[model samples]
Target: MTRCRLCGSTALTSVVDLGATPPCESFLAEDQLDLPEPAYPLHLRVCADCWLAQLPPLIAPEETFREYAYFSSYSTSWVEHARTFVEGAVERLGLGADAFVVEVASNDGYLLRHVVDRGIRCLGVEPSVNVGAVAREAGVPTLTAFLSPETGAAVRGEHGPADLVVANNVYAHIPDVTGFTRGLRALVADDGWVSVEVQHLLTLIEENQYDTIYHEHFQYYTVASAARALASGGLTLVDVELLPTHGGSLRLWARPEGAAGEPTARVAEVLDREKAAGLQELSGYTEFSARVAKVRRDLLRFLVEAAERGETVVGYGAPGKGNTLLNHCGIRPDLLAYTVDRNPYKHGRYTPGTRIPILPPERIAADRPDYVLVLPWNLRTELVEQLSFVHEWGGRLVFPIPELSIVEVTS
Candidate 1:
């Protein structure tokens, strides 16, 4: 933390301090509830040299991912998103049966299954043993190991150089950004394409999506800074696409420096947008802490008022981001009652710090709470339809990010 993780610079400035919270995905079992829990400083800082927004590497990847609780297949919309990405990648990269594809941190084979269907050889390098087992059971060729320069080289040697390397929603998870990017280089063919999807810092600040900040995500990247990180591993940013997933994300296309020609116009366009948003300078970040404070205040006020009015407020989706929001707001079972999730693994567990009980999604219908707080608000569209049954009991849904808003479901 003394030096920037990306640039090794000591000139790091505070972005926002979210106090301290437990690791976002560390759900506690019933027996462990009475034991002491651990928390870390959830403060975010920006590197003055590289403009990369990041948190200190308080927790190691091995501590969190070895036996992960998150299963990507639980989210129907995310599964569909993976399917679409595979189809597009096949077409965009002219991949065929001869093509070799690799996905880093491929959870539960949610994405590479599509590659398998198309007869393209694919491999998933995942760090989590439990989730990697599920991927192997589902027929994905998975290696239960974390991605690193050595791991990547071993994969390339054993499986042959990959034609396409896909890393989705994992670019920000590693504390060693430069090393991880080098791993990507080692796995991919000299002329092969590398695609990475990460939450865009610009949208994170503009949309008031501070809840996404957690220990798991070591760094947040704008295209400008991302390009610099990619260069450290000899990868050149070729094209950029703005994606709607993970609130707002960037799909960066990169290649080995020798094969990467000039970057696409879209890359310049996105960089211009980032600069215009004041991200390259300190101006854009100056007011983010105040806005984040306002969000916390507004959400706490609503929950407090709901309690006073004798209205029941429960949460939906025990996602990692939801844990950050709940812990930061200091919400416990008293204010939230209990939350429901589609993931069976979390049904009987409690959220890490807040200790909110996680029940099956059907519990909402069985108990019919007055308000269902939508924690994974990024999946709002898909969840609304899934929870439309709330309309039967005149129940409404609540969203806390991008400002708090409530919507009454109609049958």
Candidate 2:
């Protein structure tokens, strides 16, 4: 029986099957073409008791993120998001110079830089060696290891419990849900709070964002599921806030049970909203597979049509979501000439599974492809503004998911 990760209940049902897929960030090298590609079952299941949407068991964290290619400092929007988060957190938590802040999965110290600038002692826990090196260079005291119960104990012994623990967009990537949350419980000071940010599962299903179904994202969270997960580790969900970043996300505030202020009405409001939206029921995910299948078909048809017309069709963004979409839709060099990314680390590599080369944004301007498919559709507005020059050649931007549509510039 595949028990719920949060409640350990044996009552679970298969909700959506995305088939086998490689790790989205496993970009390949030209010389490594002969290496056998590994693809695992990308099936999602819903826990009846906890309502936590999650993929079936597969790859371990070491295999998934040891040499992670993604660096948070590469994206301007993400950097801005981090800056805003730091400002809000410092003010809301009433943090001062003497208080210590710690962030898990702090890629390139994107968020902690602001914390450090405030004269607050800070630490970052990052598993990826390459990315950790970058964070170290930024003057952030980074521990190059995964966040586990043992690590938490060790960190507490050395630095004492943290006043604030920030885990942005890392909650979903952890496979050992129980151990991870326990680690949070051990590391947070009695009066401290831990804020976890994750892409909302409700938003993912409603927006047809099946492309976010990569191997690394093991669990999809709603307020109820997250509450249950934290409570299991002796933490309480005190508050929840919705954010527009990453399409849609939830910032959950948690603290040790009986440690702080009472749970706010906002927490109940989000839970009630999720339940009303059928997030707690298994039938809520029944239509998700069909919706995603339709997306796959539509995207494939559009790319095939563009190819037959001899029009150059390229992709934008090398995000994990983009890799999932490309691989699922069978996109390759024959269909997409190349993909453009602003990140220097990803520029010269080939996308996993599809093997489409990743080039700099300059390639988009130089090629002026007839169609530039925006893979990270969530960033459409920002990307379109930056690449508006494509309109100079009568080229248009295409969004594949939530339906395929092309946008034309008037000016």
Candidate 3:
């Protein structure tokens, strides 16, 4: 029996099967489209002991993120979100010029740049050479190395332990949660705070967000599973805030054991909600595979019927979630002609497996696709506003996850 990554339990249950999917971020150059792209099994499992829904390691971090293509600065809303976090963190944590801040997986210094502007000392540890260079260019003092206990200790030796450690949207991507959390303890001061943001498992299940599952995302966490992972690595969960990001994400604030503060009611309240939602039991995860299958079938039917009606469909964002939905349903250029992304790094590249071309968002205004499938549904409100001009041509927008909904727009 394979051991669970969180609890080391051999008792695991299947959650959802996405078949084989290529690494979502592996966009191809024009000349490389003919080359064979590798796909790996995307079988997700939930640990019976800890109820952590996880995808077993299918690809290595070096293959997926070392030369990462995704850049955080491409999205305005996401950058604003990071700034909001930094502003609140500064006020709440009493961060000032003397305070030191460190961020793990700080893509392009999107969040840490705000801290630097305040004259606070900050550093970013990013493994991806592509984006790490961007962070350094932005004067955020980024290190091109993965964040492990060794790296954390070395960084701490050079510059004293950080007063604030930020690890946002990283918990899901890292394969070794145990080692990472332990490294987090080493990175922060005993009296300092560490904040980790991860998409909640409850949201993934209830919202039919199976599209969020991909090779890079190794695990999904409920509040309970997350607490357990942190506890094992010498940290104590002090507070949790449920934020309306990435469908829904929980920002967990933890502290080293010796410096652990009083627990907040928010922690218990969220855990109770998860239990009431049946996430504490193994049975909660068993029914998700059926929901996932329905989503795939429904999306395929919609795309197929739209094609028959001579309605053209195109995609909006080149997000990781979109890649999962595309490959799992086997959607190709026939269904979605091409996708538009705000990121120049992804523009001109072809999506892995499906081989759909990626272009800039500016292309949407010129082409005027009949139905624009919004792949990053979490940003539907923002995307809808930005692409509202499509209404002039009587075009509609399609949302596939949670359910298939066709939204018509008027100019």
Which residue runs does candidate 3 get wrong by more than 4 Å? Answer: none
| Candidate 3, 31-102: lDDT as tens digits | 997788788999888888888888888687878778998899887889999999999999999998899999
Candidate number with the higher lDDT (1 or 3): 1
Best by TM-score: 1
For residue 100, model 1's alpha carbon misses the true position, in angstroms, by: 0.1
CA-RMSD of model 2:
1.3
How well is each residue in 1-411 modelled by candidate 1, as lDDT tens digits?
Answer: 799988899989999999999999999999999999999999999998899999999999999999999999998999999999998999999998999999999999999999999999999999999999999999999999999999999999899999999999999999998899999999999999999999999999999999999999999999999999999888999999999998999999999999999999999999999999999888889999999989889999999999999999999999999998998889998899999998899989999999999999888989999999999999999988988999998999999999999999876
Clashing pairs in 2: none
Candidate ranking (TM-score, best to worst):
1, 3, 2
- Model 2, residue 228: distance off in Å is 0.5
Q: Considering lDDT, where higher is better, how would the candidates rank from best to worst?
A: 1, 3, 2
Please provide, for model 2 over 195-287, each residue's C-alpha lDDT reduced to its tens digit, 9 standing for 90 to 100.
999999988888888888888998999988888888877789999999887778999999989795788999889888888888888768788
Off by over 4 Å in 1: none
lDDT of 3: 0.91
lDDT of the candidates, in the order given:
0.94, 0.87, 0.91
